[model samples]
Target: MRTVAARTTALAAVVTAIGLLPWLSGKDPALSVLRARSAEQEATEEALTAIRDDLGLGSGPVALLGRWADGVVHGDLGVSWVSGTDVLPSVISGLGVSLGLMGASLAVALLLAAALSTATLVRGARGTLRGGAATGGAPAAMLASVPEFLLATVLLIALGVWLGWLPTSGWQGPSSLVLPALAMGVPAGGLLGRLVDDALPAVFGERWVGLWRTSGVTSRRIAFAALRRAVPAIVPQFGLVAVGLTGGAVAVETVFAVPGIGRAALGAAKAQDLPMIQGAVLVLLVLGLTAGALAHLVRVRLLGPGLRDAALALPSPPRMRAGRVARAVPVVLAGVLLVVIGWGLLRDPFTVEATARLAAPSWAHPMGTDGLGRDVLARLGHGAASTVGVALAVCLISYLFALTIGFLPAFSAGVADIANALPPVIAGILVAAVLGPGTVGASVAVALISWPPLAAHASALVQETRAAGFLTAQQAIGSTPRRILTRHILPAVAGPVARHAVLRLPGIALALASLGFLGLGAQPPAPEWGLLLDESRAYVERAPWAALAPAAALALLAGFAVSLSAWAGAGPRGAAAPAKAVS
Candidate 1:
């Protein structure tokens, strides 16, 4: 009870702090409002001062927070500067749409996870359970690696363009939900499936399972029992997956033109609407925290206190070695990327072919032509460098930042945690609003947002490694702290850090793509994948190949990054390895 009370108090404090972020950021809210209204720059200083005073910007933080909290408790969410309407109603309407999408996606993910788990668990005696689990897990890992936008693009092309099976965009009926849900759910499902697979074997190995088997329990009954026991352990993980999916929905909603909170947030961010941005972020934070709390309660209720701890303490499953095909995947992907970049550099990607506008695949143009008669293949080839380059840059910068600050003490660690809690999309929007849109803005945004989680992970590992026996021995021998870190700790943590860097590439790529799609990255005439998709949206039906080509390239690149990470042994097994062993 005391713990719960402490947590509640902490949550309230954090939420209050978050609510004050916009004011504390040092951004001029009056200027933001004026910009939204497109007010003339020559407007007198008197006008600015009047606007600021009207908004009560002169008030102290405590007073402002108290007023905001009072209004919130009375069901008010302030008024939007852009729309001139009460924020609560619009937020509520947007929340309903987002909730529907999230709920559907969550249900689909859980079902898919269950099905995948069952398939792996029911493998025949002829196959080794380890091999079966690995085989089953590989697909999910690959899926999880693919960014949501890339997945959404591919599904849009395959189902909407090629097969004509579903609407390409918009939120009209049940059919529209299918593609978006799959896009959002598949990666999450893949992750959850792997979690279930890992937990089931441990549960089946319990002494109670042996007793049940000795007492003539059927195999089906035993499997059912194991699943029931495993679920509580998996529930907490589901919260994390849900949070990620919700964040990714910003891109998904944009791609599909869904009128959800994500879409509203994007618009609000673009317009620098402080009220809407604050309201959207607050709602999302509340939902994520509530879901996490509920999942914890469920776990405590279902497993009891002692068993839940035991389940969490179970040894992680064995690491599976990458097979021959897995090893060759990165090589093949790298070669293809090189070919595209080389081809792009040698030829003019912007050359027009007015005579063959909207042309299908042929000897003249392999990937056909867009509405503007530009070769899709050439555009994709050129875009490859920008897409892949931004991803690489973000990954390198973020990793370097992580390594540098992550080795620092608790102050840096606390800052990292706070930064990590800010969603990447929101960060990108804020950066773009301040810096103005371009590759530089997008890259900086992504790197800033991506570094926090990596820093937190690396810091924890460094702290753990510092406490190991070898480090202690070095310290006892009068070794300098710098030398100890450089010679011993650095090498110990390098593998995990490298793995994290690789794993983070796909997400960085997705973030860049999302920004580009929103016109905040790689401005006009630049062959960026997201920009290409954005430009081609109006002509999708007329020249589907233009969008399809870049979408496929992005998907392939994301997949390759994922495969490379997996091949490097950066999966759950590697992450869960003991720090003592590394030392």
Candidate 2:
């Protein structure tokens, strides 16, 4: 009953929010429709009134919502404000394409996860916990850090254009699906594998495993059984992965020319076609909710009635302690970053040389030239101030906000739930509507949606730390609430949150890049990494280096974050800590 009520509340809230988008955007919907329908038309009150009345926009907000709700109940989704076509058919068709793509991507993710799990298990139980996991996690983190959009571009250039092994873009045969699926799958698989690997160590240490081994259970069978036991705990993560794949498909679809719901929604959002946007978003929302329910059902089947709700509870933090290799990796990355900055300071990224257009990598241009013949290395250097600098600023601001509200997560719990469910790209669109599409809008949007994770972490840490014996003793000793928070609570919460912020810095930068790539960030002639990649896409066949240079910069950033964060986040060097339940 509680589940049903919660879902119902969520459904009602989303529907009402969709109805209020035009009002919240502060854009004249009638004028927007006029522009979308005929860009040259002048905005007149008479014409505006006609459009408004025709679309029932003149009605009060309550009436408008009522009409929309009624239409939705009767299998009517209305028509697109821009295209003036039935919304239902287009939404359904696009949903089908997106679902097919999501299914393929999820299948690839599962296969990669299974392969990684098998390799980890094959190391034998003795070394699996300490040796195999520590070595395996860093590489997985590196792979996971490679953003899907960058991966898609690389695949298109190498596999599609260079080798001519597959179609570059479009919706045709099965060959068209390969690159996009791989692009979305690889990163997801790495994260999933890491989570599963974390869970498996706990099962291996269980007493039943040794008992089963002594009772003549085959080692392979025992491993398989352990996998079965570990998997149920993390089934929801796969569902989250599915939801992420769907949300991320917007960029992949734009890159690959897949006419999925994500692309359709993006186009609609760009045009401010409210009806189309709502319809598309509604479909995606339903798909996400459905996927979660299905995942829950699968977990139940895996465990049966007696242990259906039982899950492996694992403690958070320190999958691996600070090793020499971990410390060395970040230092090396920072040094390379300094070198790029020094080189960039000496060159002018904006000077266009028509004669050197699309030039390949050579000593004259270490990173080659873009389509406009702008030096790539210089742009990498100059763009750092915008791309990397903005990312750092955004992270700090997000952390501040997280620290402020995270102490009482319940206050923002509903908001966080909505934000987490919505794609970062969608957030970009909403921010663009209010602030206009540019660097500020993109940065604000990324920061806006990204804080919830930090806040969640802060909330968890506060809960865990507040329950500590030291904190309890201080309270009993007559420490004021303010002093406890300032002296003990804030310091405790800040440490983990800061480490988490550093770990998330790469992702924040990538989010900014994604928005830029989508034309929601820094405009052209800006030298931003995302804009550089976006421009390179046109002539990628001729100048892959133009793309690779910026990409390498981003990759190094991810490497630095993954390595140093591991060391910063490590707790104590001791036995694998006891597991904690997330469910």
Highest TM-score among the candidates is held by which one? 2
Which digits, one per residue and each the tens of the lDDT, describe model 2 over residues 1-583? 4333444566667668776676667778788889889899889999999999998989866887788878888978888888799999998888888888888888888887777666666554433455424335556656666677778888888899889999998999898899999988887787777667666766776778778877888888877887887788788666666667766788899889899998888788777787887788777777766676677788889889898556655444335456787678888998998899779868998999999998988898888999888899999889887887899999999989988888786775666555555556766766665566789988888887777777777887778778889988998899999999899889988877786777677778888888887777899889898888888888878778888887777777767766765666542222121111000
TM-score of 2: 0.91
lDDT of each: 0.71, 0.76
Off by over 4 Å in 1: 1-28, 38-42, 46-50, 57-70, 124-132, 161-164, 205-211, 308-311, 350-364, 371-373, 408-422, 433-436, 460-464, 570-583
User: Which residue pairs in candidate 1 collide?
Assistant: none
Itemize residue pairs with steric clashes in candidate 2.
313-580, 314-580
- Per-model TM-score on C-alpha atoms: 0.86, 0.91
Q: For model 1, how does the per-residue alpha-carbon lDDT over 555-576 read when each residue is reduced to its tens digit?
A: 6776777577668773522243
Q: What is the Cα-based lDDT of residue 321 in candidate 1?
A: 75
